[model samples]
Target: MRGLASASVADQLIDVVSRIAVRDLATLRRYFPALSPDEIADKLVVGTARATEAVGAGVGTAAALPTPPAMPAELAAGVLGAATVECKLIAELHVVYGLRAPGNVRQRAALYLAEWTEGRA
Candidate 1:
């Protein structure tokens, strides 16, 4: 059923966001050393919940149609923006730590996400 399918998608999105947010706290604190642990935790919790809600709303909207539409532009834009921010932060951290990666922003981001998710699994 459409409702079931939508629910499944929402669950997956939430799970991914939750996992990433939990793991990202360390990185967040590392990048923002001035922030207290409580501050980082609060940001992770609120940001992940907000992202999950946005993605869930997008999925619900698509599921209501007689035929599913292409992925919404707003959802796509949000995803891209999030990924870019993550990549930029990571790259900056690498620089701060005197580390190096092999490629451009897109390539490095793709590799980082791949490795990050793989570790989660």
Candidate 2:
């Protein structure tokens, strides 16, 4: 029941992302059988770093606030954008391999997000 204002949001975000990384390693290998998982992971790591930077930049523009209650909408938007990029990467990989996911884009993203959250417990 923690609100967005909780400091744990950052920790939650990191935990979810780490879980996604571990899960996606196997997923990428499955979709791109010809490619090395390590290499793909390296590229993804680089992309994630860039996305993180973008989000940081977005958050930096907001006025200094004591809590997330004062956080700017742009910051939330930036985080959402980063999440979208991560999800889209997975979807696009399936498309590239001619593999049809079982559901629509939102459903597929939710499935991936669920995998990410599974590591929380």
Candidate 3:
């Protein structure tokens, strides 16, 4: 249901992700159990930041940046995982919690994801 039609929310999401990617290993692992501390801490550091910044910069681009070129398989997977979580929770909050509009849903979801990820970090 969610799409990239909303630039503001998408921008917020990028900011959240950038911060999360920089988190300590123990902290990232605690929140994202699917990612090992080493997995997240090692190669993910660069990939995640790049992805985050790409999305952020693309907010004003005519077209969104395609997924980064040749991401480490692991970082690619982590980004997908995080994005899936963001999409699903955002849908739930919109449908169940009565938030309306794709932009609002994304912004709230970004906030929630940031809080959850950062808290553990």
Best by lDDT: 2
Report the error of model 2 at residue 17, Å.
15
lDDT score for residue 119 of model 1: 39
List runs of model 1 lying over 4 Å from the truth.
Answer: 1-34, 68-103
Ranking by TM-score: 2, 1, 3
Q: What is the TM-score of each candidate against the true structure?
A: 0.39, 0.47, 0.27
**Which prediction has the highest TM-score against the true structure?**
2
lDDT against true structure, model 1: 0.50
- Please, what are the lDDT tens digits per residue for candidate 2 over residues 9-107? 554444444344223435666755776545665566577568767766766766355577666565665665565556445544444445545665445
lDDT of 3 by residue, 10-57 (tens): 575555543432233344456557854354444444554466566444
Better of 1 and 2 by lDDT: 2
Judge candidate 1 at residue 108 and give its lDDT.
52
Among all windows of ten consecutive residues in candidate 1, which has the lowest summed lDDT?
14-23
What are the lDDT scores of the predictions, listed in order? 0.50, 0.54, 0.46
RMSD of each: 10.2, 8.5, 13.6
lDDT tens digits, residues 1-121, model 1? 9999766644444334333322234556675688765565455546645765676676566656665355464455455445433434444444434464576544555555554345346
